[model samples]
Target: MANLYDLLAGGFPIDRDKPAFLLGDGSAVSYGELESGAAQVAGHLIARGVEPGDRVALQAEKSVEGVMTYLGVLKAGAVFLPLNAAYTPAEVDYFLGDAEPRLFLTDPAAFVAEARTAEPLAAAVPRADGDLASLIYTSGTTGRSKGAMLSHGNLAANAVALHEIWGFTPGDVLLHALPIFHVHGLFVALHCAFLSGAPMVWLPKFDDAQVLAGLARSTVMMGVPTFYTRLLANPGFSGEMAAHMRLFISGSAPLLESTFAEFEQRTGMRILERYGMSEAVIITSNPLTGERIPGSVGYPLPGVELRIGGGEATGVIEIRGPSVFSAYWRMPEKTAEEFTADGFFITGDVGRQDADGRVWISGRAKDLIISGGYNVYPKEIELVLDEMAGVTESAVVGVPHPDFGEGVVAVVIGAGDEAALIAACRAQLAPYKSPKRIVFVDDLPRNAMGKVQKNLLRERFGSLFMA
Candidate 1:
């Protein structure tokens, strides 16, 4: 209904006395404290000449100070762009240039001085109009990456919708260990927590022992599939340690059926798998008290609409919602291609909604592979392989994996022998997608739609895959 700052102000007054955030070291911040902290940071940005709709870049480790900086930028009526702390200087420079932030708010001691030099240049120019809220860059299946422009309205609606659908309330406590740069960590975790007036116990990163201890105090926790697997590995995991938790949500990558079963057996908490991306934070989620299917992404959240195309359960997932991002930053043609005439964001994820209204994700529109919860686009690897000789054609697909979730395997149709093909690819592609075992295939299966069916290839080489 209102912008992020407006909603925070209204909600703050009612829950002023409530605890808003709690650090891992047992430090707590009240809603009233959070409000003032944000304002103080907002004052810093305002003094630096930051205006409404101006971009502010944040690169910091996950901490109360970092969280406050994010909210403060939003409160100042400016767009916030949080870079992954793990990003190399080159990657950081690319994002800073693309977003054109007014301020690069990072503790300079943590990053190289050269990386922060561009911040001064970005701050020199000022922008007007309160249209832009964020510019999140996502790696494309193609070689080029695009920045999705999220508006104030789009972000505001999503936080509210999440609060309504997920039963978030003032009483809830979320164990926040997700990265602050990603939308799930910021929008769904912090923004939604703000709306509910709930307290969050923030952790810098996911650590099984640390998270297990935090779960002893908190009621809710959200993580990717990889988080659950690592927790299950810790022999200390028990039903008693998980008794205090209210919910366990999994997303950012597909939840493996084995991981879900193992988690339930150990913790007695069923992992609620959900679907989301940079374009639209989250679309579907398992209900608080309904059928919790193992592999499904659950039903669409409030204010979200989804439909399956081509009469296939695993067709491209189309979503229309207020939370959908406005467009690609400064790329009008690319923005138009991302959404349909009726305004639905065409999620490149190939998925199908079951009879029970649960969405099951199959794969991506490209050779995009999700391994260990990180998105690895195969096109990036293919481009590397294309530089090598004797490589006629290369197709990368995810094979069933036990440890890493999905093993990036390649089936190559080459001009030379197996040894030569492997040697050529070894010189180029990343170790993750460089084909664990390159099987010689006569041809790749293509349907009437001219789409290469990777599933067929997977079935053909099922013996080579680790079950």
Candidate 2:
């Protein structure tokens, strides 16, 4: 039986002495070392009575040991559920109550404090391609988070597709700094490197100085838009500094066109922006070899099909592919609602494909503000606000309004004048699309992946128009 673990293990370097991960603390784990560590962790998991299909919830800090735990869960034929380390105990309690995992892994101190115990199984459980590999919970911004059930095939297919598209080779060194709890970091980043036998320069988190230093020795760097923006702010980060680098990829949030242009001008390399969600590991990516458009998420990956539904030019983006997840864990009804009768997952994102087949994301369907019975896409207003002087980024949302039904509200991150920003919006956008109220903050509320928590923004200003 072909398992995802078996596929990943196939990429183990012929020379086992080769480094698998170069840790932040100046230690390197060889391919052979990683295999041994993973095997030991798998033994521990099996000994703890983890059976095939059982959920193993892990909420430990990002470390070499944590990645081994993930691989061990796979080797044990159990479902891996990696929760954000930043999640509070109450939030973890909710997840535990919801998933009811067979085992929970945390820090050593916390494990002792909880006083949980388990016994080993007699043997390792067998797994197939279609079996559940993971249950990654979505950020519960709008409502309760749903656990997207990713199958072994779903993960394997995505890894294979990315390995080919990104042209990952053993010669490449991945500068990994993103959180491992999310799809981008854990699946997309780690899988590509592991499947290609490529070594990774792993960091605890995104530190501009450390990343800049790492770039000298690293060939590939994958990060969010914020990472690029912060790097651009540093005078030390120059085109010469990244001359040895091969590729720079960005995702997890919308990459502002201005930021994209500025990065290209500074680094002399265009960031390859891609689009993906927890339901699908990676759908569309700006081509690795071809022209990487600044604003577009280039083209759909091999084996994935993308189409715009609802409107003529732009609507809800729908997808169907082997990489798409099977279902939302234990939420059959919600899962059924998310997919079309023909099997296409109705991705809640609103987007349009250009004449060249490049996809442009407008905004989320829920983020579209219907003010005065007029449809207003927040991305349109946000684009204008982001270009204004003194503005870094902006999030536009809909607030309840008695007459208009929903009024447009703009939350900005910079010290831009509210009246001037509103005036600027009025100059560019239609009157109904203009922000009725402008809220300024030092920073926008974001999830672990750097995506703006629009639902939280809505909740904060939901009653603004009512007043």
Candidate 3:
């Protein structure tokens, strides 16, 4: 079987009775359930006329059913499109219009229940290396979302690389609290456990109380910067509590140097941070056994080619790797513009690489806001705010946030009602993408060329969240 599911499922323990997921209720979901559940889900899709290469969109809360549905989508050779559960109908409308999935699942539990009665499909659908595995929608600078097309080969290679580099084993237990809508939780984290046949102590979301309890039973944990900060704030998260854990990995947002240092001081362990995007799942990762440094994303994985663009000491990061997505869905021109003539994908991140090959990300060339590990694009919200009745124009920028890595701040050049504008945004965009604060201004600071100086706005309101 060429399906990505085959590759992952092949690594399962010979004894299917072994647990694959250890839930909070003291019960366990065995690896055998994954196999049978996926088969039935595949049968359900096939019965619904879903074919290989078709899209299957899912917008539901995280649960065991959600994980099983993801596996079922792969087994059926369909592209899995996972949307944020927080997305409003307005935001979800755009994704549904763009991707046009053959089946849209809003109720994962019901779908799994329905799938249980379907005839089991004993084998996975054959998928070629170039066959699409997923469509990850990332908002563009133009306020439109582009679905990054990931292939089976792309995921398999990245999963294998990450599984090997992370030193995962059957004995390791992963503490999973991250959302599965995007790459971090959906692919990077899940693949590691699947490849090693390791069980995950699954938590729906990051809660201080639940995580503290889960940590005691887990050996390896993966999370974003916010998770670490929240855990640190809890008095219960002492070094003694995390002493049983072997590794703590962080990514999906920039981990503040202060938090990293403080976490080490409190826990007696340094959190390994990595760099990635929707285009490429995991580009660079800090070493497992070696010294993990603060503010550095460490070295690129084996077989990944990374270089700073324009031959400058510090410039845009460019990469060519098996894990990198081939192109934006249905946007050939856009895809062509993003890649260099030599085929390296422009990562749109401004950074530098040391002579020893370690990479340091200074900033993003694109004004992307990663709030609480979710990618929130300013242009997406700015477009909504600019069209409001009382707003002349708006500039959205991300400022420092204590819990969330960044907080969205909107500065407008009109006499718009602040509360009304925020309410409108909340109605249209997801909560994380909506502006936390709205500042009415006489005029937006602009460059001599008349372009809005978002940098200046960021500086002005940078202390709002911190203070």
Number of the predicted model whose TM-score against the real structure is largest: 2
Every model's TM-score: 0.75, 0.95, 0.80
Which of 1 and 3 is the better model by lDDT?
Answer: 3
Computed on alpha carbons, the lDDT of every model, listed in order, comes to 0.72, 0.87, 0.88
Tell me, what's the RMSD of every candidate? 11.3, 2.8, 11.1
lDDT top scorer:
3
Give me the overall lDDT of model 2: 0.87
Q: Model 1 residue 135 lDDT?
A: 77
Model 3: CA > 4 A from native: 139-142, 367-467
Residue 378's lDDT within candidate 1 is 56
Please give the ranking of all candidate structures by lDDT, highest first, separated by commas: 3, 2, 1
List the pairs of residues colliding in candidate 3: none
- Residues 314-375 of candidate 2 have per-residue lDDT tens digits of 89999999999989988999999999999999999999998888999998998888888899
lDDT for model 1: 0.72
Clashes of each: 1, 1, 0
